[model samples]
Target: MTTFLTFTILGLVLGAVYAIAASGLVLTYNTSGIFNFAHGAQAMLGTFLYWQLTYGWGLPMWLSLIIVVGVVGPAMGAALHALIMKGLRDTADVTKIVVTVAILLGMLFLSQWIWHPEDARIMEMFFGAGAKVEFSGVVIRYHEIICLLAAAAIAVGLRVLFTRSRVGVVMRGAVDDPDLLRRCGHNPDRIAMLSWALGSTLAVLAGVLITPVGGGALEANALTLLVIDAFAAAMFGRLRSIPRTFAGAMVLGLAATYVAAYFPTDWTWAGNLRVSLPMIILFVVLIVLPQDRLRGAAIRTRERYRAPTVRKAVTSGAALVAGVFLLALLMDDTSITTFGLGMTFAIIALSLTVLTGYAGELNLAPLSFGAVATIVAFHFGITGTGLAARLTPWGVLLAVLVTAVVGGLVALPALRLRGLYLALATMAFGVFLSNMVLRDTTEHTLFGVTFSLFPNGTLIVPPLQVGPLDLRDGRTLLMTATVLFALIAIGLVALRNSGYGRRLAAMKDSPAASAMLGQNLVKLKFGVFMLSAAIAGLGGVLMASAGGSVAGDNFHIMASLSLVMLTVVGGIGYVSGALFGGLMSGVGFTIIIGTFNDLAAATPPMETIFKSLGHLAMVATALIGMGVGKNPSGMVHDLFESYRALRNARPVLIGGAAAQAVLYVLALTGVIGNWWFAVLTACLVMMLPVFGRMLAPTAVRETPLELVGVDEPYTPELRDRLDRELGLAPALGGDRHAVA
Candidate 1:
């Protein structure tokens, strides 16, 4: 009875903090219509700042609280609104989610860089150690009492603000009908900004309150993920209701405490289960929530995808493979290995192109599915033929099939959800996998059959071999991965250009309309998800084969988040985008930092600057992710369009190709320095379109029309000429300059 009361009190204190944090999340989402994935990151930053003020600088705790929760938090919120959130107002839900996630990553790494995670920075609980109230053999600290009171006050205050305040009503209206609010002389943007400030203040307060409850340690990832526990509470409220959110927080907090206290300590599964309680709560809540109505295709989107013809796909794919082989010739074995890893990532990213790009379903657990495949392959394929010698092709097939089945099972629960809720469901699954399965090393017995999911906390995957062709060699593996990526990419392009692909696109546009047209929305969604999972599983097998081992940390939920961000930034809708994103994210930044490190070793004077590039590279990736809002079509699309002028200018294409070939030959023959050849080749490619426009015949170039004849006769010849000039039709036999 004493232990129960003690745990109960502890639960209430934790619940109160969760209530406060979740209320802030609900507030911002309600007003701005953006579920801030970075809410936890904001809280983490506030916690660290408070610690720095009070513990590091020896400021009074009261002063630190006021600075962090009152002034700095609101200022940070307002600045985020003005800079990042404001631009996201008109973007897609995926873009908004990715941007917030990018903010989370940016802040997390920035905190680590600044605070150095190895350092011990403990914050003192409020009112010191002596301030505790003991009643009936149950000891409750003053800090716990204060937290409970603060949460109650916040709840009542927020309820009043939302129900009876003019500002709050305007804030509600901002999300429901921003144009209407604007028309009523209330600036919706200002209302959103105000809500963000208020929300941020609450988040910071929660962080400050929860720190001491969590042993007063200022750890970046721990604090951030701990705050993520509030997500279940927020979801329970359906991201709107304060009362329900509070109730849900209490339940979650009590449940976690009870499990930790009552569950058998000697049971290996109990620890992971306790850690995964919040994700379980979140998953259950999302699954039980009512299905959101299928939205109409009324929202304007900047998303564009061009389906390549079979010939074009084949040519591009062949070129890509040849290019990889050529690149291998220039790079050493180590570099080739890195490139192989990148190609595996590219294969995984191609799955995103099929799912999110064509089918328009957002998944946050692609890597989790890959992790599942890796484990399956390891257990099923290993025949005790030494650590890295065993190879089984059938095991790879089994892994893919099992992963696809698992994906289908996951999608079953998420079928009723869409947009943000669907994303949350996948995130929960990913987190659960990370905590319970990937990290678990326990041996279990079922029906008298004993097996360990991950023995020794790692899965050693053997290198693959097919028909006497050894892929253990880095160069061979690189070539094989390149070939696989090209084949998959080409096949995906063909799928995109096919009838089924059009159906997927139509379904993405409007599920209701698709259903009306007799399309099986459920089957289409299910099939695509399974296919995507299969693709991801194949990528995983390849990755494991190349690396020869796998671990839980390699496929952590955070890495999955980064993959989503980078894939979106690279262009979620295009095959080429996936390749670009996969390379940039998988190994590009690492390679950049490594290159700088090597240079630093060679040049002593620039060591500091080069060493700093590691953190800068991570931050730069986050910045790029944030920029996805501005270019929803992705960086690859922008690059393609930027160079589209070269398509019609034969002279420019010839000249550019000739120059690149010369550079390649020069570098190959050692006539010019390799670095110089690389630089010159890159410059020539980037400037090709510029040179195309500069040197092309005026008739072939795209320029603003003089608009001299708006009322001119709409003749077939005129139409043809106009179409040719607009680059929308084949050129006919005529004076090319006739249209102008």
Candidate 2:
């Protein structure tokens, strides 16, 4: 009884912090209509700031707490609202989710860069570590008591604010009907900003309280995920009710504590279960709880998906393969190998293209499916003699097929889910896999064969030999992946242009309208999920082969988030976008860092600058993702549209191609630096359209009245010009009433 009581009090302390954090999440989502994926990251940032102020800067604890929770937190939230979140209105759920995730990544890396992970940093507990009271043989710490009181105060405060206060009422109505709120002379945006500020303040409080309990270690990722425990609590209330959220937090905390206290650590599943408890609860809550109704016409995306013809896709793919082969000549073994690994990333990203791009389903765990495939391939394939020990056709087929089945099964529970809910469900599955399946080390026997996932923490792949061809060589693997990606790209293009593809697109546009039109939404989603899973699985095996090994950390949930972010940043709606994402993440960034390392090796004085730049890559990725709101269609689409200006300028295209080719040849021959060659070629490509427009301007096309807003932004000037053209503008000798 004493042990249970001790654990219960401890659980309540943990639950209180969770309740505080979750209340903030619920508040932001209720007012802004965006489920902030970065809520934990915000809390994490707050925790780090407190540490910096109190420990690093040697500020008073009270001063640091006030600066972080009272000022910094609210300011950060308000700034994020004005800069990023405010622009997300009317954007697709994917855009909102991705942008928040970008903030998460941005904050995570920024903290790491600032704190320098090598240093030992500890946050002292409030009132000192030993400040506690003994009650009937159970010891209660001061910090614990403070947390409990804070939670209670926050719970009551928020309840009263939302239920009794006019501001809270206006905030609640912000999402329901912003226009109506505006008609009532209330600024919905301002209300949302206030809610964000309040939410951030709560996040800071939660972060400050939870840090001491977590051994005072300020590990960024760990801290962020710790705050994520509040997600389960937030979802428990269906992202609204404070009281229910608090109840859920208590239940979650108690469940985790009880399992840890009573469950045998020696048991294989026990550790995983305890580690994954929050995610499991989150998944269960999402599944069992009734979901909100399908938002009718609520889905608004600026993205445009246009399927390429088979011929165009094939030609582009062939050119890409050729480009890869030529590019390999300029790279050394290690660089080429890194580039090859990126191809696998591209393949995985392509799967996202199918699921997110065409099918309109946001998957946060694309790499989890790949991890599943890698497991199957390692076991089912590579089992025979010396040459036969390599990957076999049957094993590859088995892996893909098995993963597809698994994907379909995964989708079964989440079929009714949409948008953010669906993304969370996928993320929960990925977390579970990361914590349990991928981390499993115990040997298991099936069909008289024994194997384990990441046995002893790593799964090494044998040299990849398919039939008679050995692709273990870096260049060979790169070329092989390129060909495979091309084939997949072409196939996806064909799928997009097919009748079934049309149905998927229609569903993406409006599931309700499609259902009304007799389209089977269930079948479409299922098929797309399976297809995507299969592709991801294939990419996994290839990635393992490319890198020669796989580990649990390689497919961590955070890595999956990055994969989705980079892919979306490249252009989620296009095949080239995946390819672009794959290269950027895999090859481009790797090469940039590699070049810097090479420079640092040759020039010692610049080592610090180069190292810092390499570290900045993470922050750069986040910044790029944050820009998705401005260009929702993606970078590839923008590039494509820009190049259309050069369509009539054959001489410009020829000149640009010649210049790039010459630079490539020079780099291959060691006459020019590979880095220089790459930069010059990119410059030439970007400048081609500019040169084309200057030298051979395209004919002006008349804009139809209906196409004004559809094709281009309808600005005041454009509108006024159109009105004048139609004799409706009073300033242009038209009737004032007609203009009005």
Candidate 3:
């Protein structure tokens, strides 16, 4: 009983922090209509800031707290709300999700950028270095007491504010219908702004209160995962109920603590299971949670698409093959390898196109499928498992097929889910997979029988083969990947043009409408999920085979989110989008960055500028992806549609693709003086015609708006409301009568 009480106390301290964090989540979402997935990142940032203020600047704890929670915190919240969240309210759910996630990524990198890797800092507790209260062989620190107090105070304060105050009523009104609130002559934005401010302060307070409980060590990533606990808590409240959210946080805290305490420490996988308990709960809760209860349905229009003709696809494929053959002939080994990797990523992105683009599912777990493929290949003797037996193509094909079936099964629970709930479910599954299998020393037991699926180390892979063809050479592998990509591209195009494609389109647009139209959603969902998983597995097989190994680190859950982001940025619906995404992710993230870094080092003065700019490749992709989410169709989709609309510039499109392919090959093969210089210059030159197209003047007519009379009262408040809602500048050709 003593031990139980001690552990309970220990757990409640964390529960207190979770409660604080969860409340903040509920507050912002209820008022702002933004879930703030970056909530954890924000808390991490605040904790870091507090650490910096107190330790680095040698400020008093009181002053640091004021600066962090009062000033810096609110400012960050307000700025984010104004700059990002306000725009996101009108965007699709994916856009909102990607934006917050992008913020999280941006904050992480920013933290790293500001706090250099070499410098290390530590912080002391709030009240004192060592302060505690003890009873009945149980001990609790002052910091823990502080956490409890703060959580209780915040909870009561919020309950009173929301339940008793007029401002709170207006705030609640804000999230429900901002336009309606506007009609009531109250600015919903202002109420949302306040909610964000208060919520941000709570996040900072939670971090400040909680970090010391976790040994007072301040690391950005660790602090960020603290938000995961809050996610479970917030979800328990259905992202709205404050008291329930608090209770949920406490329950989770106790549950995790008890699991840690009771689980066997000597077992091989016990630690992983303990570490993964929260994620398991998170995933299971998401699967069980009602979809309608989730907030922030993507407030955007449906995606629009036009599948290219079979002749166009075939012609394009022929051209691409000819280009690849020429490039493969001209390219150096390094260049071929890079393109090979790019093609592999492209294949994976195509899976995303199928699952997300056509099927209307926003899955963030493709990497999990890919990782399963790697394991399957290795276990079945397709790779270097020291079994020397070459099952080769048969094994790999069978493994990929199995992965697809498993993925479809895994996607079953999420099929009825949509928008943010669907995304959360996928993310949770990915995290669970990372915890259970990828990091598995799966010595888990059931009914006294041990089932150890995978060892917790790097797995090996040999050269890929199909009966007699060995694709061990870089050139051979590149060609194989190219052929595979081409075939997949053709197949995807065909699939998009088929009657199945029309069903997918219908499902994507309106599920209810599709059901009413007699479409079998379950079958469509299962087929797409299976096809998508198979495609992703194939990509992973190529990646593992080409790299000659598979490792746990290769498929972290974050990588899955990034894959989704980059794919969306490149193109969600279009095959060209996958190709572009693959090229950008593979080459732009690796080769281009490497070459640019090399160039930066060569020129000392501009090193930092170029290096930083180059490093922003991932960040830039994320920013562009937020835009893609708003558009939903993708950047490539817009680019192609723009070209097709112009008609006369169709030749320029061909020229651009050809020139890029040829020049890239020339640079890669070292045929042009210096590889780095040629690649850099070639990129700029390749964009010349595209730039000219953008700059070319065209005769256009502008639509003129005629003055429309207003029926509302001619009071100043009503006039101001009209101006604000219309987003009209003070003088945008307003009617003289209305102005008068």
- Count clashes in each candidate, considering only residues at least 3 apart in sequence or on different chains: 0, 0, 2
lDDT of each: 0.86, 0.87, 0.76
How far is 728's C-alpha from truth in model 1 (Å)?
14
Highest lDDT model number: 2
| Cα deviation of 320, candidate 1, in Å | 0.5
* TM-score result, candidate 2: 0.93
Please list the Cα RMSD from the true structure of every candidate, rounded to 1 decimal place: 3.8, 5.5, 8.4
Query: lDDT tens digits, residues 1-740, model 3?
Result: 88899889988988889999989989999998778878888898998889888888889999999999999889988887876677655555665676677677677766776776457667677777568888998887887888889889988988998899999899999999889999999998888988898888888888888787777457777778766568888888888788888888898889878877887777666666766777777777777866663222244354555677777888887778777787676667888887787788788888988887777778777778888888887777454436453438877797799889888887797777777777877777777777778887556688997755565577667777776677777888887887888888888888888899879977876777788888888889888989999999999888777777667767776566666766776667777778887767656668757976887999989998887776566456556654553576677766665554344555565666677666666666676644554566556554654654675446232211111234433544445545654556553335534575
Show where candidate 3 strays beyond 4 Å.
117-121, 293-303, 383-391, 442-456, 600-621, 626-632, 649-740
Which sequence of candidate numbers ranks them by lDDT, best first?
Answer: 2, 1, 3
Residue 156 displacement (Å), model 2: 0.7
Write model 2 residue lDDT over 119-164, tens digit each, in one string: 7788777989899999999999899999999999999999999999
RMSD of 1: 3.8
Q: Candidate 3's C-alpha lDDT? A: 0.76
The full ranking of all candidates by TM-score, starting with the best, is 1, 2, 3
Which 10 consecutive residues of model 2 have the lowest summed lDDT?
729-738
User: Between candidates 1 and 3, which one is better according to lDDT?
Assistant: 1
Q: What does the lDDT read for residue 355 in candidate 1?
A: 92
